[model samples]
Every structure is written in structure tokens, then in C-alpha cells.
Target: MNIVVCIKQVPDSTQVKVDPKTGTLIRAGVPSILNPYDHYALERALEIKAKTGAKITVLSMGPAQAIAVIRLALALGADRGILLSDRAFAGSDTWATSYALAQAIKKIGPADLIICGQMAIDGDTAQTGPGIAYHLDIPQITFCTEVDSDGTKVLVKKLIDGGHQMMEASLPALITTTMPHDYKAKYPSFLAAFHAQDKQTETWTAADVNADLAKLGLEGSPTRVGRIFPPPAREKGEIYSGSPAELATKIVEILKKENLIK
Candidate 1:
């Protein structure tokens, strides 16, 4: 089986900052790490590979700096990695991003499965994975908590609001995983780290993927950020200090004055 895992490099939440003028993230100079949620998806992919001898390939689209996340995926047991980077791809929203990724997947030829995290921490939209599936016109299962393969078909346990539902899908499908999907990720071995460092990740651009020039970047994105601002600070609470009886009376009086209690 050939599996493709989509991963992204995100700014460490602790170090994230916004550009006041543009209302966009200040990516340059911010410390970046692999999106934590993607680790769950990667771990699931590795588990499947371990069980079925599947070949896992990690794919990412970002600036050249995204190579860091791809290398990290290799260290975690991916068979190979690919980086899709181009100046024109900057400022792409989820729609354009998925379109670009779908094209890249087509360039990779054929695959048995595509896996991704439920959502990116920075964007929190949870749309890219399904959006990719939409562009590719493939069946997609989202918020998958458990996955079992019988060689020809995949059995999945999907998380719902109150519980889970089991479903089966044919091979060559896409899945978006959430936290505690199956197991914790394993640490990278020294050998794997060394190999990852030396591995030459395949790099592709919009042209390499035969993407339409007009629909490959920010211009192709349908949504636009209108404004962004930090939430206002909360107001201070009123203090009620005294004996329990006195406090209760004060609270009742305050509530009555505020018309909260009849």
C-alpha cells in the first residue's frame, strides 16, 4: 500500500504574533514546529505501514523552511518526503491550498490512502483535508479515531458528537485524524534522524504540478480576511467580603438592584 500524509509547519503557539497592519501572522522570525495534531495522523500512518508493509510518503506545501517538518516526518518512519514550494503560493487560503495539494498528489501518480490532521492549529478551519478530497473527487472520512485495514478495504471508527460510528470504505480514500486517534508518536531513532538529514526531498512548484497559473495562489482563494484583533480584556469582578449570611444578603440585594432575581 502507498499512503500519503499531509503535514504542515506551524509557528509554535507560544511564539506566535500577528502583524498589526496586515492582520496576518508574522511568520518570519517566529519559531516553528510541526503541527502537533498532525503527529496523530502521522502515528496512525506509521502504524498502518508497520502492519501492512505500506510505503508512507509525507507531503507538505509551504516555504522552503517547510523542509523541517518533512524531515521530521521522515525521522518518524515515513518512507519519503516531498515539498511543494513557490513564491506564488504565498498567502493561499484553504481552498487554493487544497487545490495545490490535490495537483501535487496527482503528480505523485497513485496512492492507496491520504491522511491528514483534522485541522491546523493556526487556522483552525479543519477544511483542508476534506477540501483536498473534494478537489480530487474522492471519498473522505473525517475525525477518524481508529482505522483497520483488510488489504482491500479500510474499516474506520469515526468520532461523532456523543459517540463513534463505524464505516467501511474502499482503498484510495482520504482520512482526517484527530487527537488520541490510536497511539502516541514514537521518538525518532538516531539512524532515522541521520537518514532524514541526508535525504533529498523532492521539491515541486505550481508549474511542476501543472496547476493553472490563475488559480494557484492568493488570487485563486475565494475567502479573504477582513479584520483581526485581540479580544478585549475581561472586566474585574465585584468583591463580596463578610460572613456567609452578610454575603448572601449583599448578593441578593445586588441581584435585585440589577433585576437579575425577582
Candidate 2:
């Protein structure tokens, strides 16, 4: 079975800042790391591989520096890594990025399953995974917390509004996963990291992947960033000291005064 795990290199959210004038990220000096959600997705792929002996390939699209994340995936036991980098792919929105990724996937050969994070930390659009499925015309399941496959069909536990749902999809499907809040990402050992250096890793360009130039980069993006600014500071809450009964009555009175209740 061939499993393709889509991962991304993202700016550390805590250190990221927006350029007030350009409404763009100030990535000049901020450290970049693998997106945590993608890391979880990769781990899930590894789990599936351990049981099924599936060949796992980690894919990413970014600048040359982005290969760091690919190597990290290699160190974690992925079979191979592919990096899609080109100036033409710059400024791509989720739609364009998905288009390019879908094209690259096709070039990589048949994929039995594709796994991705529920959303990227930088964009948080949660659209790319489904977009790739759309581009490939394959079934997809999103918001999955747990995933398993037997080389023929995929079984997943997906999170829903008030509970969870069990879903199954046939081969050649895609899934986007979300990890628990307390999940800790695993690190590769020194030996694994050294061994990863010898693994098969290749860098491909837009032309190499046969991606449609017209559907890549800013030109292909239908949406534009108007502006970016910090959210307004939150107001402090009122504090009161009283018995439980008194507090309940006080809350009722306040709600009534505020017209929040009749």
C-alpha cells in the first residue's frame, strides 16, 4: 500500500508577526517548525505502516529550507520525502496550493491513501485536504481523530458537533486528522536522524511536476488578503464575592438587567 502524508513547515505561531503595512507575515527571522497537526498526521501514518507495511512518503511544498520538515519526517520512519519548490508557487492560496499538491501527487504515482492535518496553523483554512480530494475526484473524510486501514479500505473515527462518528472509505481516499490538545509530538533519535540522511529525498519544481502554471501562485488564487491586525484586547470580567445561592440570584438579576433572559 502506498500512503502519502502531506505535511507543512510553518512559522512558530508564538513568534510570528504580521507586517502592518503589507498585511503579510514577517518570516524573515522567525523560526520555522513542522506544523503540529501535520506531525500528528505523520505519526498516524507511521502507525498504519507499522501494522500494514505500507510505504509512506512525506510531501511538502515550500522553499529549499522547508526540506527540514521533510527530513524530520524521514527520521520518523517515512520511506521517502519529496519537496516541491519553485518561485512560481509563491503566494499560493489554499486552492492553488491544493491544485499544485494534487498535481505532484499524481506525478509521484498511484496513492492508496492520502493523509493531511485538519488545518494548517498559519492559514487555518482547513480546505487544502478536501481540495486535493476534489481535484483528484476521490472520497474524503475530514476531522478524523483516529484512522486505520487494511490496504483495501480505511476506517476512521471522526469528531462531530456533539460527539464522534465512525466512517469507512474505500481505497484511494483522503483524510484530514486532528490530534488531542495534550498530544506530544515525538522526536527522532540521533541514529534515526543520521540514517535519514541516506534516505531517498528529491526536490521537484513546478515544471518537474507538470503543474499548471496558470493555476499556481498569486495569479491562481481567487482570494486576496485585505489586511491583518491584532485582535482587540479583551475586557476584564466583573468579580463578586457571595454565597452560592446569592451568586445564582445575582447572576439572574444581571441577566435580566442585560435583557439576556426574560
Give one digit per residue, the lDDT tens place, for model 2 in 1-262.
9999999999998888888889888888899999999999999999999999999999999999999999999999999899999999999999999999999999989999999999999989999999999999999999999999999999999999999999999999999999987899999999999999999789999999898899999999998888877666689999988999999999999999999999
TM-score per model over all chains:
0.88, 0.89
What is the Cα-based lDDT of residue 111 in candidate 1? Answer: 78
Instruction: Give lDDT tens digits, candidate 1, residues 87-136.
Output: 87887899999999999999887878999999988889999999999999
Worst 10 residues of 2 by lDDT: 224-233
Q: Pick the candidate with the highest lDDT.
A: 2
Computed on alpha carbons, the lDDT of every model, listed in order, comes to: 0.88, 0.95
Error of 2 at 211 (Å): 1.1
**Model 1 Cα displacement at 105 (Å)?**
0.4
